[model samples]
Each structure stands twice: as C-alpha cells, then as structure tokens.
Target chain A: MPRPNLAPPDAAPLREALRGIRFLLRRGGATVADTLTLDALPDPAAGLAKRMIREVEGLARSVDEAASAAAKGVLGGHDNPAEKLDEIVGHSSAAAEFGRAIYTALDAVLRRIGVDDAFISEMSARAVFAAWRQDHPHGQPQDWAADLTLRLLAARVIRGAVPAGSGSIGRVEPVAVFAVLLWLQSDRSESENEAVLEAAADIALARATEIAATIGSGDQGRIAALYRKYVDHV
Target chain B: MSKVRLTPDGLPPTNEPLRVAVRRLRWFKAAFLKHAEEMGAELGSRFEVDDTKLAAAFTRWLDAIELQRPADKSQRRAFFEFAAALMMRELTVDMPLKAVGEPSRAQTGSAAAFWPEGYCCTLFCLSVHAAATAQEFHADTTIDPAIDDLRHWWSFKENTIRDASFSAGFLQMLLGSQPNWVMPDVFRAKPRG
Candidate 1:
C-alpha cells in the first residue's frame, strides 16, 4: 500500500502507535478482561458492562444456545428462530450504549498521548512504506522486514506518555498500552539511571513483542525480528 | 421492506459506515445483549430485528479489529483471526443440542451447551458483512470511540429488559431457542482466494 508523506511532528505519535498489533499476540487479553475498573465508573453507570464482565461465562453460554436455536429454526424452516439470531447479533442499542462506556475508558488512554484512533491507518501505511523504502532505496521488493524490525527495536528505547503503572494497560485487549510503552520507552542507554523502569520496559516490551508475530500477521517477518532482538536476547 | 420498523427513525442502518464501538470481547458481548434487550423493551417483543442490520453491525465491529488498523491485507486478516480466537473463550466443548426441532431448552449450561449458538451469531454476522460488501467491508471505515453513553446509557438496558415482553424477548431466545439457515440458490461468496 502506498503511504502518505508524514514527518515526525505529525508522524511521531502515529509512529508511536505502531506496536498495537503486538498486544494481540500476548496474554494481555486476560488482563484486560479482568480489569474493568467498575468502582471507578460513575454511579448508575455501565450496568450491562458490569453484568457482561461479572458474568462473562454465563453470557457466552446464553449467546451460544441462542445461536443454536436460531440455526435450528432456519434449518427446520421455523419462522422466529432467525429473528432471535438477528436480535442477538445485531439490534441491541443498549449493548452499544454500555459498550461505549467501556470503549471510552480505553480510548482515553490512546487520546492522552495524542494518538488519534481514527488515523491509525495513516500511521501504518507510513510504516509499511518506510519499511519498503529502507531495503529498496532504489526502491522495490527487498528486505522490508529487516528494516521494519530494526525500526520496531529502536522504538522500544524511546520515552512515551503512558506510565507503565497506569494499570490501564490491562483495560485493552492484547495491551495496546503495552505497545505504546514498548514503542516509547526511556532511552535505556540514557535513562539507565532509572534502574527499575529500564528493567521493567525491557521485560515488558520483550513480552509484548514475544507473540506479536504469532498473534499478528503480514508483519510476522518483522515481528520475528522483534522477538529475536528482544525476547530471545533477554 | 418489512412492515414494522425494527429500529427507530434516528438509529443507524446496518450498512452505515463501518464503526466498532468497542474492541474487547467482553464489551462486545455486553453491548450485543444490551442492544437486543433494549429493542425487546422499546420496540415490543414482537418486533423483529433486521438480520442484515444485525449481521452488518457485528461484522463491522469484529472485522474492524483487523481491517481498519493494518496497512496490508494479510495482517488485517491475521488481526481479525486473532480477535476471533479471543472470542472462543472457555466455551463448553460439547454442544449436544437436541435435534433442530427439539433443541434442549436450558439456559444454564456450559460452552458445550452454548457454543453452537454463539458461533452461529458470529459466523452469520461475518458472512452478511462480507456478502454485502464483497469482503471489502473495512475500506473507508473507522473504529471511533463510543464514549458518549458510558455513564448513563447502560441504565436503559437494565431498565428496559424489566418489562415482561422485553425479558421474554431476545434474551429468552438466546437462553432457550434455536434458529436455522438454509442456503439460497444464488448467494454471493466473499471474495477470498
């Protein structure tokens, strides 16, 4: 894909967001699921979200049975089962409402550091093209992954806006916050004075990139590089 | 067009520009149930949710997890596949649903008891989304924040499902009923290699 021209001022935050996919590959999901921060929510807020999180297992079961009955109805030539499936899958305004609540909390984290959720694509296209450009200065099909992987490794050493202790890292799937922290770390060589953070980021970003290749696709080559340079080395 | 309007005048259409209000699986389930129950309360239990609309919505949300973020198509597919894996939580392995006509009518069961139904909802949403959009569903889409309603909207879902009709409507179907699908003669296959 062709990328839009973007410089560090506009591209810095966008560049920082490059690690979100790495979260999908890690065990970060369980952390997000378990960390709802329900008490932190305002009163009379997020009832469905509470119920959904509190009783995730039950809701999954109910949704399962419902899907079966609906399938049976259609196969049996029954009239209403399809409607049932339809409702569960699509038309729940209440679900959208409360889902928005949970979404807002996670979104705030991204916005806090100036990463606009809407423009992740622009950032990625730039990364992909940049990856392509590094190997092919003349520029064509080449070792794009190697260049991209090097970039990812470099990203880990830079400082970012997300505080590692935000625990908000647990709020999102696969830990986008983890990726943000990974891509934007304190320059280890420079911040070696902050002993704890350097060690913490090393382990965290390493783990963050550990399964990023497995969980993420297309960039597996580069992600493999991420794993080798970070996790395997650690 | 159908007789009764499944949604109100101002609501978004199933094919509205792609948007995923939340990416987390737990949130997805809650949001889905909340929407279904609210319709039961306000639209009347007899009201039928438009399947295309429903499928389109879920499809947008799920697929966007991959589609909107990845610059390359392969990563996009991989991202969504990972998202799907997350959905397959510790669901009961054995879905010993009775024969289609005589499905076992119990709500409280394990993934063995419920996954078939859950899979049906997810697969159907994916299909409908792909069919209508020719698998180009993610183009020009966005996963914008759905924060406006967090503080107060959930109350409606809680309160709405209280009515007998609402209580017995979609929620009941999920817990105890089964639906089926028959292939149409001329169906659009999603453009996959």
Candidate 2:
C-alpha cells in the first residue's frame, strides 16, 4: 500500500501571518479594539505586531487621498484605484500622447461648458497634477499619465451619461475637448467622430442644458473620430 | 442562449473563486484547451485533466481516483487545471521540492491503490502561491505585506464608488477575513460541529 502524499496548507509568509493574527486576551480584560495592541502579544511578537499596525494605519491616509481625488473627480472611483488606473492607461500607444490628449479633451469640454482659463489652471494645480509633477521628474510618468487619462475618461463617460438612475459625483465633464479632437482628420474612418457628436448630444439631453457650441456637419466626423481615440486610450 | 446583457449590475455574484468560476465560461474551456494542448507536445503520463466537457471533467477525473460523492469536483479540478496550465511550462515532476505537513483526515481515506493527494497538494500550492504573489498595490514591484494594504484600498474604493447594490455590511463582512478565502472543495476538511 502506498502512502497518500498529504500536506497542510502553507502558512502565509511570517510577515503576512503576523499581519493576520489577532489574539483575544481576557487576562487584561481588553476588547476586540485592543486585540492588535502590542500589549496583547507576548514580547516576542510585539515588535512585529506594532509594525503591522502602523502599516495598516498608513492605508487610512491613502484612502483619504483617493476619496479626495474621487470627489475632485480624479481616478479614485474604483475598488482597485491604483490597479484600475494601470489597466486603463496600459492601452495607450504612448504616455506623452495619451497625457496630452486627455489634457486637451478636458480643456475643450470645460470651454464648451464656458469655464475660463483661471478655473482650468486652478484645476491643473490640484491632485492629479501634483501626482503628475511628482512622477514626471525623471521621465514618463506612465501611472500618472494613466491617472490623467482616467479623469477625462470618467468625464467623457459621465458626460455621455451613466445608466438611468446611476449618476457621477462630480461635473468633471471636459476641458481639452478640442485636444481630444486632434488627429481626428488624420486619415481614419470618416465617421470616427460620431461617438463624440452622439455623446455631446446625449450630455445635452441628459442635463437639459444647452451646450455653448453648435455642431457642424463637417466637424461631426472629426469629433467622433477623436472620441474613438478616447476608446483606444481608455 | 440569447445574448446576455453584461452590465455591471447584471453580473451575478457567486461564492466560487476565479478558478471555479472560469470553467463555466466557454472561453475558459477554449483557453485551457490551448494550455493543455501546448503541454501535450512532449509530455509522458502527466496528470492530464480530462477536459472532455467543461461541466463534468473534474467530477469524472476525481471519481476514477477517490470514488467519493461528486459534490464540487469541477471546482476542485478547475483549480488543478489552472495551476497545471500555469506550472506545466517550468514545473516538473519529482523535483526535490517536498510539500510540508501531513495529510488531514479528509485526505487519508485513499492512501493505497489510488492516492491522489500529491496531485491535489501541488495544485493547491501553485494556485495559492500564484494568488498571494500576484497582488497589486500602489507600488508595482514592491509589496508591503500587511492587512492594512487591503483596508486602505477597500476604504478608498468604498468611499468613491459607493456601490449601493449589495446589502449593508457586505463589503466589511467579506473584507474582515484576514486572508480573504474561497471555498474550493478539493480536500476540504470536515465542517466544525
């Protein structure tokens, strides 16, 4: 007879197992709240427990920033914010180009809404811009590039409208709409800008507010074509 | 079947993990077939998963081995096939690698004629290892292994997305598990009384 090769489930890394251990010590009469305190663990495990607690506390700050970004209409609107940004921006042909396009589209959409340069500059000096500045120092900030790409994409998606009864938290509409329209006339499909035109109309209808601009027949394809770039970038 | 609307709201939630959930998709079967076929080119008596039908492939394979009631065989096998497909590239049989710990009482029944514990152990390890290693955070290469990473991530997301669909406390209940878990039925220990 052969022995069945059995094994126990591998323990998570010492660091990880240390991360999940919660000992309820009734000796001190402490509640679940203090289960993570160093006093709860024996001296052997105290150092590691304290380190784990600090690391967890650090997340509160990140979450705060992400929520702030989301309220300000940046890229924190998903469960996996950092990863989601990566997944979306990874589709871009180039970082500089995608970053440039998003900025342009955001500007155009804002102008279409009749906001001035001061507001636009004010917006740029905020969170996403801060991230870009920090990351862009050495070379291409691909992640921040993705973040910029995401903000405008959300704007575009929101402007196009979420499902009925679903709504976005911010106006975060458009700024570089003209920039988004760039290269639309560059030898792509004639109806390439149809999405932009349709989305613009949809935005108008959903808001029941008039757009400051009029659509031209010749510009329709061009606008739609540029939006296809949004699809590609997203 | 008619076209199924795939809105975010429409995706039905399930208790099964990715390894099990993927098998139900026709695309996964197609993908796994590619993995198995590519593996078949030079293999000899490998632990080949009988991918005849996506539904009962795991059950049939397990029945041949354990003769136990087929409760969650597909889910168990799906995990195996997933790991096998991933490990078949570089993972070989009978390396000096020894799995630690003894078999639980659940796995001790078939110790003789057809002991399938080794295969299950390898599959479980590979799948679990892949999962633990592949986590993503703010940093790409660097991993700050702590329960806080998930808390911060979840807190930020919940605040932003405001997913109203699930019942209250659903997210907390799910996230509260220290090492988030799945109910893979392969070599499952008996329920606590």
Candidate 3:
C-alpha cells in the first residue's frame, strides 16, 4: 500500500494520539462490557449507544474546529486550496445519518445495561485500535477486527443477547470483513500497513470471541454490577 | 430472464451465481475455521458451524427462494455480492487492481464500472489516512492499494458497483473521517506470505 502523499502540518496531534494509544494498550479487559452487569446491560448499553450519538455530534463540532485551526495556520486558509475546501465542506449529511445507525446500536446495548451513558469520552480512538491489535497474538491476515465486532454485535442481536433494537444493524460475517481486508491488501500504496491492520483484525476477532463467551454464559450478572459500581461517578 | 427473487431460506436455481455464492461462502467458512484451528483459538464444538451446516444455511435460503416466500431484497443482494466479491477478491488478492485496469462493464458507463475505482479509491483513502494516523508507531511501511486500485473495475457489469468494493471503502472512510471516530485497526492490512 502507498502512503498518504502529504503529512499533517503539526505532528503534535498525531503524537498525542500515540500516547493515548499506549495508555490503552496497557489497560486490559473489554472496558465497554466491563461497565455494565449482564441483566442491566440493556439499559446501560442503550446509554452508551446514546453516547455514540452524542459522540458523532461532538465529532462534527470537532471537524469544524480542526478546519478553523487549519485555516488559521500558515496558509491563512490558502494552503492546498482544493483539499482545504474539501475539509471546509466537512462531513456529509449521509455520513452523519450513518453515525446515527451506529449510535442506535450502541443505544440498544445501553438499554440492556440500564443507563443513559457510559461516559468513556476520555477514551481515545487510537487506544481502541491499539487494544484491538494487542488482542490478536497471531498475525491478522485482513480487516477481521471490524468483522469480529460486526459478527459479535450481530450474533448478540440474533441470539437476543442484546436489546431488540440492536438487531437492525444485522450480521457482518467474516467473509465481509475478509473481502475488505483483501481489497486493502491489494493497494500498493498501503501494502506496508497491511500487517498492522491484520494484527488489529486478529485481535478484534479474539476479543469478540471472549465477549461472546461471556455473554453465552447467559448474562454473567456482570453488566448490572458494573453499572452500580460506576454510575454514581458519571 | 425472469427475475426470481429469493427468501432467506428459499430454493435457489441450480444456476451460476447462487451456486457460486454457496460454494464460495463454504470456502470462506473453511478458511476461517482453518485459521481458528491454527491459532488453537477454540472454535468450540458448540460454536462450530461446519461446511455441512453452512451449506444447510445456504440450501435453506435457496429453498425459500424457490417457494416464492417474501424475502429481503437487500439481504439477498448482500449474500450474492458477498460471494461474488470474495471470489474475485481472493482470485486477485496478490494482484493490484490498478495493474489490471477497469473491467469491461465499467468501460461503458456501467454502474459496476466505477465500482473498482469507487471501492479502491475509498479504501485507499481510508487506508492511507489510517496508516498516516498510525505512522508514528510503525515506520517504513507501505499500505495495500488493492482495495482502491482501479483495475478491478473492469471485471464487473454496469449495475454492480454498489455491490462492488465501493461500499466497504466508503463505510470505512466515513468511519475514519469522523471527528470522534473510533478507528478500527482492522483497516490496516497485514502482510501475508
């Protein structure tokens, strides 16, 4: 795979992202599932789902901020005009709506947990990917992480492990994940990063397996316990 | 050709595509199971759904299709496309789509024509962006462009782009571009022998 032609003007943000990722790497356990007990997962899961909704809203705002900051930097908004213009336009309406679907699923999970929010705002995006990578001891061959997440979510829904509303997202089987991974692996520009993603996908699968096992035991009575344990602070 | 729509567990015509889908999905299941076996990952006996079971799943859907039961058009399409793409994707795994160029249907302003590009471009953009995001950790690595290479576009008919690799790339790119995006590391492709 080829690399991105250009680099972000400031490495600070990227560096900060790395530090946050490291922190997540050292932390063990599926934090989301840990936050709620089995019986209470629906409610809290719904809350976390809602948090994703809010997260998307917040993200839109952040994109605006990043645009503004980039505009103010060296170019005074004149740097790669075409690209800058693209950024200014920001995320599309369709994309925002898709975010809603993702949030809806999260919301369903929250409902089962019996809460309105999990408040994992401090959780960095990089960290999530890192933890995913750590989860895979074997090399990840393709984009299996997303597939694993999708599979677990879908299976949970199908089995009635998650709230009823959660089933709408549907099943994202391993084949789907593999196809995308195969596509990415095909790109010359990104060939180097293939191993990294493969690792992430592998870990994602392993983690999903763990989560499924936990849930398979029929509501480990853990989600509710976590809710009572942490809801007060939030 | 009469458009015979299918239900989840409908009977499928012993035709090219449906048979292909079942055969390919079975292969996928086997491959995944093999991976599980190698890792000693415990594809638990209970969790294990063998080729026989998977074939049963496909057969059930094919049977439903033949019965003319109400079926999910979207899901049926998804199942068909998944099988198609997996076959093509695997066939050309090591080959760059750019090296191959656009497929015939893509040349005639067909929907599938843009699929290769749409899929490859979106995936390329996301992969590069994601890799760039992770550049600090793993230095001196090139990402895969097969997902975005334009060559694969030539393989499909005009109406297949949506079913092409485009949707996958678009979704992942959307995920990557989000402000509060929780980047899934799976977007990164691992090196294979």
Per TM-score, the best of the predicted structures is 1
The residue ranges of model 2 lying beyond 4 angstroms of the native Cα positions read A1-96, A99-234, B1-187, B190-193
| lDDT (Cα, tens digit) per residue for candidate 1, span A25-130 | 1223345566667777776686766766647555544554554344334322111111211122234332222222222222433443233332122233335434
> Taking the candidates one at a time, how many backbone clashes does each contain?
32, 20, 93
Q: Give the per-residue lDDT of model 2 (tens digit) for B95-130.
A: 212223333332233311122222232233233323
TM-score of 1: 0.24
lDDT of each: 0.31, 0.30, 0.31
- The candidate scoring highest on DockQ is 3
**Relative to the unseen true structure, what is the C-alpha lDDT of residue A53 in candidate 3, on a scale of 0 to 100?**
50
* Fnat for the candidates in order: 0.00, 0.00, 0.00
* Candidate 2 C-alpha error for residue A2, in Å: 87
Docking class of 2: incorrect
Scanning candidate 2 chain B in windows of ten residues, the lowest lDDT window is: B1-10
Interface RMSD of each: 17.9, 18.7, 17.4
Instruction: For candidate 2, write residues A95-189 as lDDT tens digits.
Output: 33333333344434444444322122222223343454455433223323333434434333223211223332133332233223222212223
**Candidate 3, A63-85: lDDT as tens digits:** 54564355335323211111111
Candidate 1: Cα lDDT at B35: 42
